[model samples]
Target: ASHGTVHPDNEDWTCFEQSASLDIKSFFGFESTVEKIAMKQYTSNIKKGKEIIEYYLKQLEEEGITFVPRWTPPVACKSESSTSHTRRPVSPAINIPDSATKEGLNNKEILNTSSSPSEPTAGTPDDKLDADYIKRYLGDLTPMQESCLIRLRQWLQETHKGKIPKDEHILRFLRARDFNIDKAREILCQSLTWRKQHQVDYILDTWNPPQVLQDYYAGGWHHHDKDGRPLYVLRLGQMDTKGLVRALGEEALLRYVLSINEEGLRRCEENTKVFGRPISSWTCLVDLEGLNMRHLWRPGVKALLRIIEVVEANYPETLGRLLILRAPRVFPVLWTLVSPFIDDNTRKKFLIYAGNDYQGPGGLLDYIDKEIIPDFLGGECMCEVPEGGLVPKSLYRTAEELENEDIKLWTETIYQSASVFKGAPHEVLIQIVDASSVITWDFDVCKGDIVFNIFHSKRAPQPPKKDSLGAHSITSPGGNNVQLIDKVWQLGRDYSMVESPLICKEGESVQGSHVTRWPGFYILQWKFHSMPACATTNLPRVDDVLASLQVSSHKCKVMYYTEVIGSEDFRGSMTSLESSHSGFSQLSAATTSSSQSHSSSMISR
Candidate 1:
């Protein structure tokens, strides 16, 4: 806290807000009343500052002091079929479509156009990247965001050693983290690692969803929605989840979904060209016509949860809308089972329609143009989407086989295992080089109750000299050994928590994330449920979990994996995205180091 600041004559106005000293009750006469109203009206003007600037610009145009630039393709005209925005969102006060065809805006014409604009304009690109050009072509973004994005991209180009993601791809992460370069970079790095590890980038070329998925997955892309966003229709209720999993297996299923997302990204690019506008995301219409108990297979549900995790982490803000129509009474049960894993931004897009409600104003009609609504939904359009068929049990491997394979694959990953005990917590130390990088963890509470927390320290915590004892390490009978956790950590003085404590139940696998706001050492701690009185002494070691959950009286067990991601990429050249916008805002709070735990504990994926 800085104190003893000096103030010059006019500095009083700069240092102390006049609003803080105003008193409405001190009106001594009619002059005071007038002053009160004047102040009220004056304050109101502050709210209209942006509008006033827009109005002033309009006035400037009227007065012939300023003139707007005209946008044109490098060629006198485009190819007959090229989709281009006729109206642009450059004025900041008005949203004009660059061009509109009955077909829709896909946001691709600007980037994919064969002829450069000599000078970029709204919905157009140029050979050279410029901030104003980006503002007019892509979405509106704050200068800070532009800088953060550029820095992140530059860092990636210089340091990352693998394939580089596109600027649009990087921007999505930046936007997801409210343009916090460190946070966004961390997220991107992790996703890139996951992609590389899973060979996700090649999915579009290598993945082949078996005939079973092609014939019975019951999902396909249709025409664009009214907003020019590409629309996808899914007969979720009619589709067989168990069948797909059996046919493809979890990894294959995950890979297939990744391919769909990859396809979606490509489609979104193509759609931008077709729509002649900025179409960053697609719309999903899910028809839950026949969802039931059979769809609730535990293995299938687990697979779905894993899929959600992969999608949420890699593809943020890709789904513009999720319109769930014709949901049944059992929908809640299914929603409850999988909703916990859904990101809040994605969850907000879900609009559930029960019975025939989708035909009304706040339902499908609100998103989809009525004329294009599929025939099954009581509309005239013929939906080519498949009517799914059932899959035979022969496609499924035995449950025991799947379980064995799952455990085998899980053990092969670079994850750590530890036993938790009452009072003692399992803690992992992560050191971050860049502030705002993300720290992520995936863990399963195999037994007992546990609490999870993450704290940050400016300096690495050293074992206390006052204890007069050396550090402790133990080896287990199974040849697995781990160090004992230091139990007496002071919360604020030594290390302040960056994330709130998370309470996890037994048998649950939890995945969570946090963005580091500053470069420092972070501690992720998992503690067993302990008696309040036994909280401060020596806690149990990681070997206890390896020894046997049964050996400890307060037995608790956890299998965990953690990683740190920085904000950079693996590529040789950096292509700065240049184009246009309406507005970009700073997020109001920290990214919260969360991909998000749950909308609630059990129901949101």
Candidate 2:
């Protein structure tokens, strides 16, 4: 081959290396003027070899170089009546009538007029349309809609600092608010503030649902819908709402629901990539086959309403559609309770079916494909949703206990709670190997009255076994109440009183410490305190009599935390040493006066 000559083998050109620049003179051996023209053309088509030669030949003709050009004849754009001219065949997908009738000409005219790529080619007047629907980053937005998005983004940048969300996310809020910039900005900012306050944005990473919820909560993500939206199946009918409420309370359940929504948002993003389309929202299939009166428990209803309120406000427009399947007669009652909290736009997306009506046409099949439909719904695919049953009565918690849990969740504190029943006191056993070490405690008697006592035992009590309900609830009716002192052990022989018993009334807070006098196992106990039969017999005041007849006299609730610190560290702090001896020196006015001097036990703030 000649120097700088191009060669083609098997229809592939041996072109210049991409790293090399296009040198027109060296490659084509042209004069300065022609080379300049060729260089200008090569700048755009540097990678094209044959196109450059064709372009150079045309340029050569203009520069007084004569060459016969090989050109194909142009096709005619006439109708079937033109006999002399030939036309290219049209694609079969396009509709074109062979007969030269007036209707055919009219149809062609209509097609030509609407040939712009922007016109909708399908659907009828009854179909609901979203004018702002975007695909592959291309949105068909009106000028006003585009302007609103730009202005809203600018406003957010100016008014707020930190990180801004993606434009698509902002547009979701805009679409949610009908592109009303003011309303969208207000709600988006409020949602951002709420997310920060609750740390909801980090919920998927931070919140871990309890094992009970994971094992019993009846919901999970399934495959994508026909439209590429993520699908989530919730078997609400089988779930034991009352049981979950009593076991985990409302806050934990709310946290778990928030994590679900967060995960749904993430799956939408993932499915968008996998399906090669814009998927900003998800589809939810809710099965209510076994829904009954039990699902309408008051606490559970309240929790559901709260969840709806939060999700509606923060995750607006995130649900593309909701398919309610096998809606029982009881569903109307629930809908009446929860519908008011649901947004009007979201309500429009709901497609509910009664009984086995979902199995018919325009049911789950309309949104979900036949193959991925769950087996429980008569589809081939198997669903991994939990078969939620009644939560164990053994795991039920009292109102006061649940309240304490809510406080701990909100405050993010390190406090453990316990229930104290009449015969079975809640006791924590601490093994102290070194004398003079300090055992400190802070406790609040949240409900009813309780007796607090510290006992020292030479022998350790059997360690409590880990149970599903948590804590030792072997002997008590309420959860978290555990008894460590053996029934056969005598008070004087097996364990001696290390601190005088302190009676803590409801709503009282106590902070105390005890210095170890011996190397032994120490037990801190909270016992349900009641007036003796003799004491309550002749109560002088009516209030006192009624107080003695309180309904919760047999049960008590306490939230407490305890720590054992070595004396070496305790000696360095004047405050701790002072706090340690404060209880021994004097008791609070709320506590009964004791005759014994227990120097080892102390109470302070």
Candidate 3:
């Protein structure tokens, strides 16, 4: 056996045994015969070996084992057709790694050959191209992008709505977009110029003139030529001097004449007679009776007279009546100006028409009487005393007496003459008496009782001492006593008989008279039992009840005490009695409960 070639004697003839054991039936079967023929061809020359390998490869390709390769070529035999003609053998497949194997080669080659250069790239660009192609081919698109494009188109249409004209360029653009012509035209008409024209029309349609001012313009009182047209044609007549003189008076007429222009004066003079005098002079004589020459010849009136004199001097043939008739309105206007300068009495006389019973034109007399007189009187009239009014007579007399003095008395005796009176209430009179050092009284007709006491001597009396009655008494006329008393005990008793007490403790100094009959310690006892039962059980609180009782008692005491003191010399005595009386009253009052109700029957009448 040779290591380089086929072994002949070795028992391990695996290749020869495999070939020898092949069944003839298996060899004739489709795949096995081809394999057997391939083995015989491979054992011949190198070229034959390539041919056998190619033949097996072709058989394998037909059997669908396309991934397998034969590492040999197919054998080629020369043909007898031509000497230069040669057959080219089929090439064998080179050995490829398993990684290089390609199954389904026909489908792969078809895919590669069919693919174009224009095919899309990988990633986003491929996706975009696919989307675009689908849109172009299949008309598919995302709703969002479609909607955005629609909105943009709508906005463009609105923006250009009324701007484009119906011309070729615009029409071509519209035609390309398949837009409606009528809609385009309608939008175009909404251009700024068209809108502005409509706005102007709208404003004109609503315009209205002010009717009131138009009516005023038409009324003709404002007559004047405007723009060479007779716009307002009302004419005014010349003023009538006779009528104005009758209306405004002679002085006003004269002043008005003086104010007329030289042309007016000449016109007036031409209508007059040759006599040199103002037309107003004769008019004044006729209109006013007993017209005083002195009153008429004032400096202002004389200046006006000079104008008339000059006019008469210039035109010697001018007559008064002719001038008056021609310038009738001047005299009245002048009179109105001059009338205010006259003395009030003279003006009144002139306005009143002194000689005539007629009320004067324009009711001048009535106006003066009604309006002017009252105004003048208000300015000048003094306030006069009314009937039965008081007049002060003298400082020595009492106010009442002085007030009562007869007015005739001032006319009769110089010493008893009345001065201006100052009236006051009776209470005020009392206050005046109390304020003054010396008070005088006239008691000719006393309506009420005049209870009074004089001091024993002319000198001012000393304060009285407390007496045996526990009261303070002063000496009266004829040794009669007038007492000043604390009122608590005598509230319901005779007020005249009541007396004030002089209080003294046992063994204490007794400067004034004390009650000798009472033994032991006797204090000034002020027992106050309300005569009219307290009406204030309805009082809300203890303090209220106390207040009500105190107020009522104090008011009553003050009134009674004032009357008593006013009737006599009790001021000194009463002043001392007040403190002790108030203390005793308070003690007695506090002992009683405020809530205790007084019998209503006691307060009935």
Candidate 4:
């Protein structure tokens, strides 16, 4: 029996079963008709299964679903593999928008692909030609010029910030084709000509320093010092004087001078021959009297005494009264030497003899009696003694109270007479020195002679000379003698004495001869002898002295002692008085008195 299943559609199999008589017998022999029926049934089920699969596949195709089998044959296994080949599919072309196409065209590629006359390329001969052309034309131009052309090209770009015409690019390009640096610079300068004209006009219109007299004055021409410092010279008295008249008008000058003092106006009239001039009526007489009283007289008196001690050390023969000449010339020269020191007819008689050749002699006396005496002895006068002599302040309550009509007349008469004569009369000059017990000579101008000569008296100790070994040797002073500190100490002591009233009063008569003495001349003489050498040396420098008195930092007082014998000690006592007045709290009474005595002894020695 055949074991293979038969299909239900195989009609031939049924027929074959009936036709094969031998097969039926064989079939009935082991497995009868039932076994054959079973085989046929199995074959029919297989055929039905195949038909159902085919129907489902057809339905899926109609519904647009693809059916793929799980197992697939390799390419090598396919029959068409040796005869056919596979290839990738080509992509479709993209359709660009019209706006994008237009933009691309407008951009116009700067890199030229064609080997044409206009194209630029690295390998092209035209590139070589263009470079060669640039080398030939711009080789002579500086780096600055080359940079400027490059900047100019950048400025011509459409995106540039300036408002140059679009056609400027074409013009620049044409110029570059045949460039010349000098011509380019010339064109640039021409473009700025209008600007230069506007600048010139602006400068001229705004210029200053106008042409006028006042402008010249303000510009610092007339009254400037040599180094351009500002200077103003004020005229004090007799403004109608030539100097004043030239600077200010005659009327203004006269008015200014008269305003200083009514006495000045009167003096101008009396001494018209002396002060009055051809061009102007007035003269400039610096008010030196106040300056003398304040600076030179009071302080100078103290310095004069110190100077006398130093002078006496060398010139032992020089009398003590000789130092009195250092007193101021104006007051002393009048009272002590020139005119009589009496008030009544004595002064008038002297003036009458003195002014004989000039105007009425009696007129001189009248002028003195009225103007000169009142002015000198007035309350406005200020006086102080140096080293405590008979100070005017101590003699009377005030200068006004101290006024002696006789002394005033005497002083005025002498001043008026002296003023008439250019120099002091010979008789008067002699009396001044004689009273001070000093002999004087008029050397040089006779105006600068002080009563004592400190510089002449003291000689600086000699220094050692070199020995044979070429080393200098000095002699040391013995322990018994005082050791001097410095030359300044010596100089200080000398200068201080010269400033004392006694010395200055004496020195003034001898040196100036222009001054006469007052009644207390002997007191000043004694005071000079009493000032201590150490105290003199300890006094301040002249500059400080001037400054102190001017600022009132140093108060000056004059104490009087009647007895001439102890007057030197009295003057010595004034050193303490000055220290006290100066507000030196450290000063003790013992130290003060001791220092005063010590200072006086040093001067006496």
Candidate 5:
């Protein structure tokens, strides 16, 4: 609406702009032009007015305010008691959703909720703006912020068909993105998709940690913090990060970490009810007493960074605070590698204490209850967290085994089963980009005897152009085998044997690795092992007769898995380079430590 009014004495309908100084006496000189401008302005103002009104309505809904019809009649009902007591009308809990009614109950009710960890809750408690927690960490939202939350929830509901996350969860994402609806919705939708794909909703009931993790993982949930937030203690310094990565591989470790986060979210909801306040995030205390260079193993660090990236993307604003105690001199290097991936708001929550700094004033006691502090940190309470030690090399799995195990978590086995005929061999081509890269294989001989060989070629082999159905066919024999090497190629000229052929018997399992001497294409071949014509004699012994029968079958079956790892991340993961023709010796613990030390030096530089 225009601010200036038409002069009473002006018959030409002259108008002056109130804020503009250079306006003519008759700004609206023509009636048609004035009407056109007025109509355009009216349309824009109407749209703006509608948006403002919608925003106000959303704010009212958020505050639990609803306008009932004035013509509605009062209900006639019998009171619980016959006494003349006033029956005051009670307003629905302000800012509380229907799903949040079950939370923030007494301690006994919290215990009951804990009995079913996987059971879906109505909703988490809404941390009202009046709470001090809201004013301190999660600032009180303005009307615009509330509007963003409302828009985000509606967007999710339209896209997601499953149970919608509570408003609090949606609000956390909003705050994480600084109330930017587009950014917050992007990450939130991605997280929801990830949760659905991984079946993370039922992780508590479905996932069972392996025994190694149960005995060796150095982190666990402790008591609540001073602000009623759940507390988690991690003894990172004492943990063998290399051992865990090697033992479990990156995917398994990632899944374990994800489960921990899911469990933490559950605990947060429970604490919210028990504390009678909104506890949306958890507090973590990390003890870095035994930190050293060994923890900087390349593969381990890579795994940690991947886990951090995932957590930061999906679980934003879930870490209320992070306390670092007994920070070692080497901590700076690790921090340099990790801190860049953390969110700025999350980084602000971190409090660092070097050496015995935590023991003095303004330390652990300020945030955690004195009696609840873990005994390992000089407090009387004994923490149930494991004192993780080095995992025995005997428990470590081969690279191929680890890869298969990791794949199984997200899908089916990576291993493929193939039939090896007497003439047609099953071959797989692997391209190595760097020399000293480790190529590892694990295969089981499911039928007759077979021979495994590794060959390196400067030029890639062209696979057979067509599939033929026979034992002597150039392509797949039993719909599985594939022969890659050409018959016209000479071994000495076209390719070289990188490892000696190893003959494996029926029902035997073989696992081996070879360090490549040159970067090129490597083919792993499983060939049928035929016995000599004269080896079996007539009227032979029982074992000889059985072997003759097996050889006569002319077909062998093998299930195998293979993986190539960069030399930098190899980390001496394999115990032996059992078939190396390049004079490469067995990979040992000392070699692993040396590689990690070199990598750590590079990081520091």
Candidate 6:
């Protein structure tokens, strides 16, 4: 409500257009309680709220005595009438909703405003994100996770030309890569490219499994878990995997799996709305009652491994839990063959049960509501999933025909592999044009252990030219050339280490980033991973303790890439990277030297 217009000569108070704003974020759906409390607090102190205003009012006039107007009901808002200070009811008592009542209400009115100071910006292309909405719509994430999503999403929106994923989809990749935005970006970008190339986004519409998958595929969604996650039931024991591959071929089977995952994401979204919480992942119940050697036939196992790789890379963090019930005696053989392919994070979700042990404590009942459990599992619910059967010999495809699907699996191979020898390190020279620009890397150790390090030198480093070789990749420096940077130039005096030496083990896909301070030559060096036999002070001094001293017993293989993001693109993202410096903290901090960010995955990123 506005105060009356001021008369310059008679009045000491100035005119105001609007009253002081009152902000209430949320009430956890108990809005009435908030209104009731607000009403009592404001109206009870009708005169009390005016203590300061009353003091000022006395200064304007000769009389020190003051009077405050009576409080008006919430419904009696000021009418939009000119030349009148009268109040009018917004609506009748009977017509008024429970959200507005006569028992002292402080109803909230949403303002028509362009933007709010309190609302945080989002990770979308154009719209600003609200932090509260992210916390509610996504999982409860740390500030680092939130910041990483914002920065990475912004980068993708700017860089990625095709359809960018939704914020929640991007969040999965972030979670998969441990919320390292730079790493997630590298992985997500590659996945997005693969999706566009292979049309994974349109799989739901364009792809359909052969009739064999529909009748013989032993998986379908059951009711929700106790925690409200959408649950999928897969009878692996009953599933004729070899038969399906023989009938539909691996391509058809793989496409069917993709379609299921796409459907799962859709169901998860629907469940999120149904349950009124973020549900980005789904629980799975895998029953292996008759899992035998026949199910693990070599050809079937190969197809299974291919399917696993595709899913793990493209659909990370999607399995909320996997309840493996009624595992057969041969289950260990299957697990041994497939466990390495599954990510450590994903593998942790597997709860294996041999025999009829699922009924015991820490089993299916712990995750699934007893009432919703299927009748076959000793619960009352009747499950409608197909009872899988083997495909006949006439349906089997030729061995030559199965060869066609093997070639399309190239979508997952985004990185080019290189061998890093012990003494002959794999070196890449990065020429920084601007200071404070972010340097990022994403790579996987495919064969052996390797130590990664970055160094900056004033002089340009000697490396192969950029067309035949990659722009930054070091495919063996010129044989007769001097060291990448002058060896005489002291470590601290001539060049400083940008990132600490990172030791990467086989099967670990590492991603890291650092903001450059100086515009000069930066050499990213990866040497065969090694450890000294004993303490080094007694022996010849080595600059880096983790640096490899002797020639490696074997060559290490790595697939890697590097890029530079403008300072402006990653301006506010450094904070998240700083807190993520899990091990790259051997160097002293500088104004422009960003803390190293480290993240890894089991699969080739």
lDDT of 2 by residue, 127-169 (tens): 1112212324224554345546656765776688655665567
Clashes of each: 50, 1, 22, 50, 1, 2
Q: Tens digit of lDDT per residue, candidate 3, span 1-605?
A: 10111111111111110111223445345775675565445334334444554576567657865332212225543532212111112211111111112231211231123223364222221113322322422134332223222223334455653432212123222322223334433433343344344332233235332332122211121111111111111111111221222233333333333322222333322222232211211101012221221112122243444445433322222121110111111122234324444333222223221223223354323222332211112323221211111111121234343343431132132211111101100110112122101121111111111122111111222233445222111111111122223323333342211123222221111111111111121121112123356565565665755654433332210001111112112112112221111122232122222332111000000
- Output the worst ten-in-a-row residue range by lDDT, candidate 3: 419-428
TM-score, candidate number 2:
0.47
Q: What is the C-alpha lDDT profile of model 1 across 1-605, one tens digit per residue? A: 11111111111111111121334554466766665576556445433543454465566556865333434457776543232322111211111133322233322332233323463333432112333345443566643355455567667867899988766678788878766567888989999998889888888787677777778888888887989888989888888776777666787777767887888888877766665555678899989887765565555677899989989899988888887777654444456557678876777777666677766556677678878989888889999998886766576566466665653355445456676554446667788887645455666677788988788888776643433221222222221223223446666876787676778878665665565767778888887665568643565565645444433556577877765545331010011111011010111021323353211122111
TM-score of each: 0.49, 0.47, 0.11, 0.14, 0.50, 0.48
Provide the lDDT at 297 for model 6. Answer: 48
For every candidate structure, what is the RMSD over all alpha carbons to the true structure, in angstroms?
20.1, 24.2, 57.4, 51.4, 16.5, 21.2
At residue 504, give the lDDT of candidate 2. Answer: 81
| Candidate 1 TM-score, C-alpha based | 0.49
Order of the predicted models by lDDT, top scorer first: 5, 2, 6, 1, 3, 4
- RMSD over all Cα atoms, model 5: 16.5
lDDT of 1: 0.60
Task: For candidate 5, give the lDDT of residue 419.
Answer: 81
Distance from true location, Cα of 1 in model 5, Å:
14
Q: With candidate 5 superimposed using the best TM-score fit, by how many Å does residue 558's alpha carbon deviate from the native?
A: 31
TM-score, candidate number 3: 0.11
Candidate 4 lDDT over residue span 457-548, tens digit each: 13332322223111101111110111112234454453223223323222121222111111112111111122234344455667744643
Candidate 1, residue 153: CA error in Å? 1.4
lDDT of 3 at 476: 15
Top-TM-score structure, candidate number: 5
User: Which run of 10 residues does model 1 get worst, by summed lDDT?
Assistant: 570-579
